[model samples]
Target: MDDKIILAEESLKRNGFQVKIFNNSEEAKKSLLESITTDESVAFGGSMTLSQLEIYDDFKNRGNEIYWHWKGEDRKKELAEAYKSKVYITSTNALTLDGKLVNMDGVANRVSSMFYGHERVYIIVGKNKISKDYDDARERIKNIAAPKNAKRLNINTPCKFTGKCNDCDSPDRICNVEVIIHRNPTGANINIYLIDEDLGY
Candidate 1:
């Protein structure tokens, strides 16, 4: 792997996150399963990376309560009252080599839940998601992840046409709330798994 990835991983660790670097997604899947079986409750954030992993099924098969943003039209109401419990399978968009967890969301379910909902949260990231710094990471998600994701969802965002970030506040802004996880909370409640392979938007 590259030095940037190593540096980023080390920085993440220093911030109090339990960091695990995997060689590939297959390895990541195996490890995530182990964690899920041992944990009492497992929750999922809105992560394209985790969605693409398609590994949450394993957690469900094990009789674990897998939580995620409700897709129902009444999700806002339901999620507002959902149990704030330990999450064992949440993924995050890695922002920088300086070790920030930067992310954008529409409903704020994914981002808000990260703060206090789950007693324990697991963050999975791919090496390709790493950037040099906060600005670079933001730029990447704006110019790359956001546009591509909008196109993928057919959201009709400005990025779908401009092919880059104009930082527009259009109603279709896909890059709304952003979060930079500067440090993991006290105790090893948050675990991070970094795969060498590329994953996520």
Candidate 2:
């Protein structure tokens, strides 16, 4: 493993999160499959990273009940089902080298589930998402992830056209809620899986 990854894993471990590093997404996916049982109820937030990894179908093929608003016909019902699920999986916008998970969301469902309700939370991060510190991480989210995501979602925010954050008050702004997870939430078994490749915005 690279030194940065080692340092990150150690730091996350110190914060009481189960940390795993993979050389690629395939290895990470296999590890994820083995970690959860077939009958478990799995839920997910809106994550392009997980979509890139094709995890939803994998879990479904393995007989795990999935609740993802992106894949469901009914968004509200899916969100509710996801909240009640045993395992929640998602990706972070930025991960600090000092072991903090940072994310910006519009609806806040994804960030909300990371801290509570779920029995286990799996946060899969690509190496490109890692930042030197919290300030750098937040910047990455605002200037990089949020803008790119807004464009991807076709949101009529200034960032979507400018390729940068204007901190706009646009109704379609995706940067409504921001969450920073410094440590594992009480009674939650949180896992941080760091993948080598760049996978998401």
Give each model a TM-score: 0.87, 0.97
Q: What are the C-alpha RMSDs, in order, of all predicted structures?
A: 2.4, 0.9
Residue-by-residue lDDT tens digits, candidate 1, 30-89:
987876554576667667788778876777677866555533256554465444546646
Clashing pairs in 1: none
Q: Could you tally the backbone clashes for each prediction?
A: 0, 0
Strongest candidate by lDDT: 2
Evaluate residue 62 in candidate 2 and report its C-alpha lDDT on the 0 to 100 scale.
74
The ten-residue window of minimal lDDT in model 2 covers 1-10
lDDT of each: 0.74, 0.90
After superposing candidate 2, which stretches have Cα over 4 Å from the reference? none
27-137: candidate 2 lDDT, tens digit per residue: 999999999999899999899899999999999987899999999999999999899999999999988878889889999999999879988999998888888999999
Which lDDT value does model 1 have at 201? 75
